[model samples]
Target: MEYRISEPFTKEKFAQLKAGDTVLLTGTVYTARDAAHKRMVEMLQEGGQLPFEIKNSVIYYVGPTPEKPGNPIGSAGPTTSYRMDAYAPVLLDLGETGMIGKGQRSQTVKEAVLRNGAVYFAAIGGAGALMAQRVESAEVIAFEDLGAEAVRKLSVKDFPVTVILDSKGGDLYSEGRAAYLESRE
Candidate 1:
């Protein structure tokens, strides 16, 4: 399942991904936390071009702390995903195929994913130190005044993530946890 992000995602690849499937997301991923998403959606509504192409892009909702010397980013992990739900449908319609964040997405977003053939992935919410190791490089792309909320271009290597919601109405977080709880009972 190791593949570069630039490659066209085949149905086979998508099929291989399920809830809790771990992946090393390499290639270019853009950081767009709350503020960045709001601004991006605003620009889209205004009919302005996005700073980066939305087609087949992967947006990671994160606001990493300032990195120490020789580090790519500090505690780089997913933030709550629901915050970006308002903007996700628009991005999905624009051809954005992948999203990485924590927590549940709104039902509207889930419906949009089903309609658009997109996938929602989640990284460990508090595992920042572990996550930082996977990110090899980072660069700011837009909204510099937003500080950590600025959109950043991240180059990651084998960055771990789990598929939370698949394109079809399958939700991993709920099902997976329920399965574990049921087994225990």
Candidate 2:
């Protein structure tokens, strides 16, 4: 399903996405990894305002390498999501609706997703070259001193991803693996 972040993604729209659905993400997606997540959470704890609104936004957990000439970003791909687990619940509570990363999230995050009507999407872990093509523009949004770990606002086109975890507690990785193994047996 194709969507632009400028509008609210309805629950029905989110429900239409399942494992293996192709997505064209044509809107602003915030890039953040472990360091950025930590800072954001710290700010929240201190009662500080966030640089950008998290409500109905998609947070892409990535630390893209520097772009070469005529490129938007370099080697863009998702990092492990487990590192962001500690801070994710806070953002979720603050109305962040979607997350893009690889690997599994903690049980707490899964519960938060269910309770918050959020979804966890996964980009191919090692497909950096393929992922870079989807990025149309990139600029640092906050925490610029963090270098590659800085928060970035990425404008992407036809950014492909899979729904690894859904708001209802459905897990594609484990379920798909189980089905594959069962078929071979």
Give the best candidate by TM-score: 2
Worst lDDT run of 10 residues, candidate 1, spans 2-11
lDDT values, one for every candidate: 0.84, 0.85
Q: Could you give candidate 2's per-residue lDDT for residues 95-163 as a string of tens digits?
A: 888899999889999999888878899999999889989998999989999999999999887788888
**How many collisions per candidate?**
0, 0
lDDT of 1 at 79: 94
lDDT of 1: 0.84
Residues 15-92 of candidate 1 have per-residue lDDT tens digits of 556666666677778999889999999998898999898887888999999999988788888999999998899998
| TM-score, per-candidate, Cα-based | 0.91, 0.92
At residue 143, what lDDT does model 2 achieve?
99
Question: What is the lDDT, from 0 to 100, of the residue 149 in candidate 2?
Answer: 98
Query: Quick one: best lDDT, which candidate?
Result: 2
RMSD value for candidate 1: 2.2
TM-score (C-alpha) between model 2 and the true structure: 0.92
